[model samples]
Target: MTKPDLAKRPDDVSSMFDRVSRGYDLTNDVLSLGVTPYWRMRARRAIDPHPGQQVLDVACGTGTVTRILADHGSTVTGLDFSHGMIEEAIKRHGDHPNITFQQGDATQLPFDDNTFDVTTVSFGIRNVQEPKRALAEMLRVTKPGGKILVCEFSHPTNGLVNFGYDTYMNVLMPGIVKLVSSDPEAYDYLFNTIQAWPEQATFASWLREVGYEQVAHRNLTYGIVALHRGTKPAA
Candidate 1:
């Protein structure tokens, strides 16, 4: 029942996620019309993690993408601000020797500089109260020449598609969430954040501003989602 406002106060956001931790992954699948997994696949491909790589998955809810990264033989750390979400992730993936779940703030990652070979967040950064700071943190933790990929809901580029997608988000999604989500009001916050998120190009600029180089993005699902990629400059 608890929902955070657009201000995105960390405690409020964390508590809201905790309230919705139960069935959260299933709710995402239903709300995204089963396309959530595909989006994650695209993100993983962008990073292309390898054996012995250290990858950090920020705001990893239930360790879905974390497990996907682990499947590639990478050692993945799944971090989330919500304790309940971390608990769910550990419950689901605790046995995976390659994956570890931790509760931490995105803006202040609890890791040493240049620690990870790759850092990524799927459908999570927009929830951070200070996304720019979080991006900087991601950049800070990534080793020189390492990569970062962000997969998030984005605005459609084509007019017709945009119209249809807007209608679906504004008109159809609310009703669907009410029916399927364990905490329906939390999705109201979700809708607001998606609407308020920056467009693809602008978001890519955030990575550039945070010192990532070779930044670029590709639209997926008619730009209803976008995957942004960047690399840390070699020291």
Candidate 2:
């Protein structure tokens, strides 16, 4: 598989995701030691989707978080830039009455402003070509006073844990990916992005700059992953 230029070219990133869509979730589960479900649960709780709420799950690969939102009684639209990912999502959750999937870019969402009660992206922001624009789009689409949840990998706070985490991410993860992932080299890029991402505080500031109010982040798994939450100010 051809590797995408992670620094530029959004279409390349989309194509990369398409190539890896078949084993993406399984690769995540394997690398994270099956802990991704727990992380998704935490993200769902942060958003607290309820009956009658309309949600947009941006970068909703394979509909994991989308299914969670729908199960909690919200009407959800799972959107991703990768067509293959959307195809898999629909195949898995098409029978569900409350959820729909679409192919879309986070930086240029295909919806009117203030359309959703909540907007979220899971483990996906770092992959976007323009993360700030994506955040702005997420803010624009969400209802005033509604929530925006971002779940992504973060630097661990504990020194000992950080050492372990770094070792796993830098070394063990790639080895594991080689055995399981459809595109093992992509994990190299994943490792680099995870390491390069801003910490909890810096990311919270980004949310605020994007016009989200009361922005905050909660560290999970000893800060290995974080769930950031913010509210869009009411008009």
TM-score of each: 0.97, 0.97
Model 1 score (lDDT)? 0.92
Who wins the lDDT comparison? Answer: 1
How do the residues 109-207 of candidate 1 rate in per-residue lDDT, one tens digit apiece?
Answer: 999999999999999999999999999999999999999999999998999998988898889998999899878889989989999999998998899
Clashes of 1: 0
Model 2 TM? 0.97
Residue range 1-235, candidate 2, lDDT tens digits: 3466558467777887888888888888988999999998899888888999999999998898999999999999999999989998998897899998999899999999999989999999988888999999999999998989999999899999999988887778777888998787778888888888999999999999989999989999999999999999999
lDDT of 1 at 227: 94
Candidate 2: regions farther than 4 A off: none
Question: What is the C-alpha local distance difference test score of candidate 2?
Answer: 0.90
214: Cα error in model 1, Å: 0.2
lDDT of each: 0.92, 0.90
